[model samples]
Target: MDDRLRERFAGLWSRTIGPTGAEAAWRALDAGYGAAGRHYHGWGHVADLLAGHDAVRALPDFAGLDHDALALAIVFHDAVYDTGRADNEARSADLLAAHAGDAAAEAVRAAMAMIRATAAHEPGADPATRLMLDLDLAVLGAQPPVYAAYAAAIRREYGAVPEAAWRLGRAGVLGRFLARPRLYGTAHFRDRLETAARANLAAEAATLRGGPEP
Candidate 1:
């Protein structure tokens, strides 16, 4: 990891888990991102989410948010990612509960809740949840070349799956995103990300469906 990201985690860990535990957590998260077969969910993904969070944080609605807690959540949201498992968020949340300070319980709780909501991403009433989910989904709005690379990286992570099954499953996911009335949860994101996301998803879904991407 770069020094800035390393130092960001360093500050978070030192404040929440102290120097020793912070060191350990830092090593674990850094190593986790660098682990084998994590093309899509690694450091690049975290960096994107961090950038999205920064963009959203500037918005009037989220200006008063507890950024520290959300930052913790963003870094660790996919900390235990396993493409085949449904428990990654829960496991990641468990890791946070074990390491974070008692003073952070409320934020941790909110973060964990937001992380879990990524599973279905159904409509939500909580403002924090909306922003968190939207930030994570911002990758959908990336320019075509970037989105294509993102798709390829994900396919790499699921390399074990047979091509036919991967096609069906991946198509289902893209179809669902297309089905959503609005891919973004926040108005800010809807304004900024929705159009590109729609184009990307439609193009991907076409490719997955045996048609040429638009």
Candidate 2:
């Protein structure tokens, strides 16, 4: 999975990070994505985001955004995922910063910002940031079975926690998404995914609370 992703990144950023530097960064990121307990936040997630990005990258509104930064951010966003840590985003940002030394200054900065924003999936005013968030959370709006599989994969990742505790923690996270004025940040995603995402989140939250799902 990462081999192809690595190749794509190498091809895309060869000018900025150079071929050798790109190879090194890919090696580091490949290992990070292969980290233990990364059931959902692993290569599959990166692949999904990359595939989604391809669909939108050519869109006129997105064509001007920093493709290199967005691509790098997608790779590093969950690079530091650990079941025990709360600072995964910060750590991931640090990892990207450390490994992306040869990338352009602005590109690296953009990558770090997008990576850090994943901590809360906060909405941002800018189209670039909005697209990043939308791509990251696109799975929330996936078809029912796909979304269910994603939910289960996430539960497996947190298997260390007792069921009751995990339920409470996960429910709180879902509730916050529910409380958001909007789940999707970009107009493209908002139009295509918002309703499904809200329904999926709300239904899962209800199930966690032992109530009927909507």
**TM-score of each model, paired residue for residue:** 0.92, 0.93
Error of 2 at 4 (Å): 2.5
Best by lDDT: 2
Per-residue CA lDDT of model 2 for 76-170, tens digit only, reads: 88888887989999999998778767557777788889988888898787677789999999999999899999999999998888888888999
Global lDDT scores for all candidate models:
0.81, 0.84
lDDT of 1 by residue, 1-214 (tens): 6788888888876665556567667777877787988899998888888877876687698877777767788888888888889888888777777766574567778777877777787759988778878888888998999999999999999999988888899999998888878888789889988999999999988888894335
Query: Model 2 residue 112 lDDT?
Result: 87
Residue pairs that clash (backbone atoms under 3 angstroms), model 1: none
Best by TM-score: 2
